[model samples]
Target: MDLLSIKDPRFLKDMNIEQLEKLSEEVRQFLIEKLSVTGGHIGPNLGVVELTIALHKVFTSPRDKIIWDVGHQSYVHKILTGRACEFDTLRQYKGLCGFPKRNESEHDVWETGHSSTSLSAAMGMAISRDLKNEKSYVLPVIGDGALTGGMALEALNHIGHEKKDMIVILNDNEMSIAPNVGALHNVLGQLRTAGKYNWVKDELEYLLKKIPAVGGKLASTAERVKDSLKYLFVSGMFFEELGFTYLGPVDGHNYEDLLENLHYAKKTSGPVLLHVITKKGKGYHPAESDKTGTWHGTGPYKIETGDFVKPKQAPPAWSSLVSETVRKLAREDDRIVAITPAMPVGSKLEGFASEFPDRMFDVGIAEQHATTVAAGIATQNMKPFLAIYSTFLQRAYDQVVHDICRQNLNVFIGIDRAGLVGADGETHQGVFDIAFLRHLPNLVLMMPKDENEGQHMVNTAVNYDDGPIALRFPRGNGYGVKMDEKLIQIPIGTWEVLKEGTDAVILTFGTTIPMCMEAAELLEKQGVSVRVVNARFIKPMDVEMLKSIFAEGLPILTVEEACLQGGFGSGVLEHAEEMGVYGHPIRRMGIPDRFIEHGNVDQLLEEIDLTSKAISEKITAMVPKKKQQRA
Candidate 1:
C-alpha cells in the first residue's frame, strides 16, 4: 500500500487483518526514512504503528475521541489523518508540530506535550458528553510511565468512583524517556505475565452456569469470589478496586489482540483499563536494542549503521560537565546527594549514579514530589542537588515557593536547559524559569557566562548554605574553554566586566554572553566604545557595579535569552528604578511576549532579533555623536 495516499483512516475499516499487517510495515518504513532526515520522536512513533492503526479502525474519530498523553507518539496518528504531505517540514519553523496541535487536524481534539494530563482531560470531556446527552467513547491512551504521576493517580481515583463510561488505554511500553522507575512499574510487571485474567473469569462463570438448578445464583456468588483469583493471577485487580473493569495484557502489535480488546472496551460500561503491551522502538534493530534511551529522540542518523550524524568536533555537553563535576564533589562530601525526576540519561547523571549509587535518587516523573523531597533532606542538614529541566520545573512552582524558599532550606537546584531549547517547540522550551523563580523570596538565581564559569557556579551553589541557590545552564555543548584544575566558588551577587568602555554597557549572562561580546566588538569598529558586563547573578543584582556604571553616566542595555517580562532584564530595570538612576536610557532586548516554535537555535534567535547585529543596532542608537568624540 502507498502510505502517502492514505488521506484518512476511514479506509482502514475496509482492510482485512493481512492488509492491516502489511500497512503497519509500510508505516514503520515511512517513519524510519522520514525521521532520519527530519529528526523526531521516532522510537515512540515506531512502537505504536499497529496500535494506532487498530484504534482508528475500531473507533470513529473526531466524534469518538482518542486523547494521547504527551502526544510525542502521535506521529503514526498524524500520518493516518492526512498529514503525510507535511513530513519533510516536521519540527521546523512554521511546520508540523512534534506534539498534537488542535488546529492541525480535526482528529486532534486535545493538545498535550506534558505527560499525565490525558486522564484529567479525558475526565473533562467525558463529563461534558454526559451533560450534553451525547454518545461517544472518551478513550485516553496513557503510558505506564505516565500512570505513576500524582495527577494520573488522582484522576484514576475520581474516574473509578464516578463510574463514568470511559476507556483508559494503558500503553505499557516499560519506558518513559528513560526506563521507568517506581512501585507502580513493578505492579505492571506482574500484570504482563498474568495470562488473560478476563478469560479465566469467563470460563469459570460458564462452567458454573451449566450446572442445572440454583446454578445461576451459584455462578453469581463465584463472580464475587473472583476477587481472590485476581489477587493471585494479576495485579490488574488493583484497577478493579479503583472502580475500573480491568481488561487484559493484550499484545499491542498483534492486529487480532488489539482489535478484540479495543472492541471489548468500547462496549463496556464505566471506566475500563485496557492494558496493552508494546515494545518501544519495535521495528528498527538499533532503536529496539537501545537500553540507554539514546534512540528515544535523535538527530539525523545513517540508516545502515544507525550511527547518529555529528559535527567533526564538538565541545563537552553542559549536562555532562555539570554531572561529572557533581560526581567529583560527591566523592568527598557525604551529605551531597543528587536527585532527578527520571532524567538520568538526558541530565547525564548516569556517571554520578554509578559513582555514588547510595546518594543518587531518581524520583520518576514527579517534579513536585522531588522538590519537596529535596527540602525534606535539607532539613536533616544534607546538601540535596536537584537536577531538573527548566520547563519541567514549572510543575513544582508551589513547592519552590512554599517549601524550599519559605523555610530558607539549603537546596541546590541545577536548572538544566535554562534557555531556548530548539526543536521541542514552546511546550518544552526552557525560557520561563527566571521569570517564575525570581519573584520568590529567599531564592538566588544565577546563570554562567561559559563552561569554565559554569563549573565554578556549580561549586558555589553546592557550598552555599545560606538559603536556596540555583545555577542555570543552557542546552547543548559549552564554549570549549580551558578549565581550572581546582573547583573554586564564585562570590555571591557579583558581576564581572568582560570589556571596558566609555559608552553604553550591555548586561547579559549565559548563552547571550558571547553574542553581546561580538556586538561590543562590532560597535568598537564603528567608534562606539561599548562595555560588556557578565551579570551572572540574577536575583541579587550587582549593586556596586550598578552604582559605578550609573555614576559614569553610561546608557544601559540588558539582554537575555529568556522571556522579556519578569525575567533577568526585568530584575535590572527594577534595580534602576529603585536606585533612582533614571536619566540615562535603558532598553531591554529578549524573547518577545509569545511562544517560540520548533527550529534550529540560530534561526529562532534570528526570528526574535536576539542576535549580535540587532544588539549592535540597539546600542548604536543609544550612544550620541558627542560621546563618540569624547571616547
Candidate 2:
C-alpha cells in the first residue's frame, strides 16, 4: 500500500479491518520518516493514527464536516486528504501549513491553529446544516486538555442546551503540551476509570426498569435507582447534565473499539461526547517515554537515536534568563509568585516550580483566567509574574485591559516569543502584542537589547510598584553577551544610546538591536552617521532623549520586528507630531499589514524587508546625498 498514492479518504470505506490496520502502520511510518527532517507535532499526530483513520471511515468528511480543534493533530488528517506528497516541504516558506487550511482540500471544512475553537465552529456548522435540512453528521475532535479552556466550556454549554446533532470526540491522552491541570483533569481521570459507558450502563438501566414486573407499583423508585447509577458507571453525568449523551472511554488505538463507538454515535440524537483514550507517541520510543513535553513540537531529530539536531553550545534561551531572574527574586521577596497558562516547560519555569512549588502555578489552557488570576493576586499586594506567549495573550485582551490595566494593579507580565516565531507561522507570530498593549492605559511595555539587559528589565519589572509592567522577549537564545553579576533596576521610560551619531538616528530594541548596529555600520561606510538607540520602553518613551534628538533636527528611522500600525514606531511618530516635529524627515520600518508565514527567522526577516541592509537603505534614503564615494 503506497501511501503517496492516497488521493482522498474515500478508499478507506472499501478496505477490510486487516488492510486498514496495515494502512495505519504505513501512515505511522510515513509520519515518523517525514517529520524526522521536517519536524512537526509528531507526538500529537502519532497519538491519533487509528482515531483519525476511523473518523474518515465512519463519517463523510467534505459534507459531514470533521473539524479538528487545535489542528496540530491534523497531520494524519492531511495525509488521508491527498497531502502525503507535500510532506517534503511541510512548514517551509510557502509550503504546506502545519495546521488545517480550508483552501488546501475540500475535506478541511474548518481552518484552525489555536486550541478550543473547533466546538464553537462545529456548533455553527451543525446549525447551518440543520437550517438547510442537510443530512450530514458534524464531528469536532478536541483534547481533554483543551476541554479546560473557557471557550470550549462555553461552547459545550451552548451545544448541550441547543441539542445540536453533532458528535464531540474527546481525545484524552492526558496531556496538552504539559500534563493537564485544573479540576476538569480530575473529572476526566474519574471518567477514564469508569469503563465502557454505552452498553453496561444502558443494560443495567434496562434491567432495573424490568424489575418493576407487571404492575407500576415500584416504578418511580426504580427510575430513581436507574438515574443514580449514572454517577457510578459513566461518571460523565457531567456531559449528560449538559444534555449530551455520553459514550465510552473507548480505546482510541484499537480499530474495533473506535469503529464500533463511532458508528453508534452517528445513530444517536443530540450532541454525543465519545471519550477516546490514546497513548501519545504510541510507537516512537523516545517520544513515548517523554513526560516533560519535550516531544510535543520539536526541531529536526535523529530517527535512529532520537537525538535532537540542535545547535551545540548555544547561548541560554531568553525564557531561561527571565524565569531564572524571577526565581532568584522570589527567594528574597515572600510576595513574589509565578503563573503560566500550561507552558511551564516552554517558559523554562521548572527551576522556579522546583524551588518554590507552592508559589509557582500552571493554569491549564485558560489565558483569560491566568491574566485575571494574576490581577487578583496583585490586589493583595502580592507580585504575580504571568509568563505567557505573545500570540496567546490575544485571547486575554479584555482581562489585561479591564482587570489589570484599568484597575492599575502591580502585575509583572513576561511576554515570551515577542516577535515572528518562525515555524508556527501567522497564528503564532507575536507581532501584534505591542499594538494591542501599547494603547492600554496604566501599562508599561518594554523590550531588551541583550540577555544582560533582559535580566535587569525583569528585575526592574518585579520591583516597580507603579501599575502593570510587561517585559517582552524573543523566542530563541540570546546574543550570549556577558551577563552582569549584579542586576540593577533600569529607570522607567529611559532609552540608552548604543552608538552616537550627528546626521540620523535608528531606534530599535530586543532582537532588532543587533540589526540596527549592523545597519549603523553599513551607513558609516557611506559617510552617513547613524545613531543606534535602544528604545527599550515602548509606552512611556524617553521624552528627554526625544527632545534632544528633535532639537538636533536629525532624520529619524524607527525600526521594529512588529506590525507598523500602532506599534513602537507609531508611538514615535505620534510623539514627533506632538513635539511639533511632524515636518521632520521621519521613516518607519517594520512588518507590513499582511500575516507572515512559516520559515526560518532570517528568511522571514528578508521576505519582510526587516534586514540590516533594508534598514541601511531606508536610512540612506532618509538623509540627503552624503555618500563618501569610496576612493
Estimate the TM-score for candidate 2.
0.98
Each model's lDDT comes to 0.91, 0.92
lDDT, candidate 1, 1-631, per-residue tens: 8777878889999999999999999999999999899888988888899999999999989898999999999999999999998988899888999999998999998998888999999999999999999999998999998898889999999999999999999999999899999999998999999989988877766875676666577656766776577886776468989999999989999999999888888888899999999999999999999888889899898888999998867999999999888888888889999999989999999999988899999999889999999999999999999999999999999999999999999999999988899888988889999999999999999999888998899889989999999989989999889999999999999999999988899999989988999999998988899999999999898999998888888889999999999988788778888889777688999999999988889999999999999999999889987866654
TM-score of each: 0.98, 0.98
Q: Stretches of candidate 1 above 4 Å error? A: 212-221, 628-631
How far off is residue 138 in model 2, in Å?
0.9
- Per-prediction tally of clashes: 0, 0
Across residues 1-631, which tens digit of lDDT does each residue of candidate 2 receive? 8888989999999988899899888998998899999999999999999999999998887878999998999999999989999999889888899998877899988887789999999999999999998899999999998999999999999999999899999999999999999898999998899877668777877788657465575777777777777776756578889999988899998999999999999889999999999988878998889898899888889999999999999999999999999999999998999999999999999999999999999999999999999999999999999999999999999999999999999999999999999888879999999999999999999999999999999999999999999999999999889988998999999999999987899989888988899989988988888899999999789999999999988999999999999999899989988988868888899999998988888999999999999999888888877443431
lDDT: worst 10-residue window of model 1:
207-216
Steric clash pairs (candidate 2): none
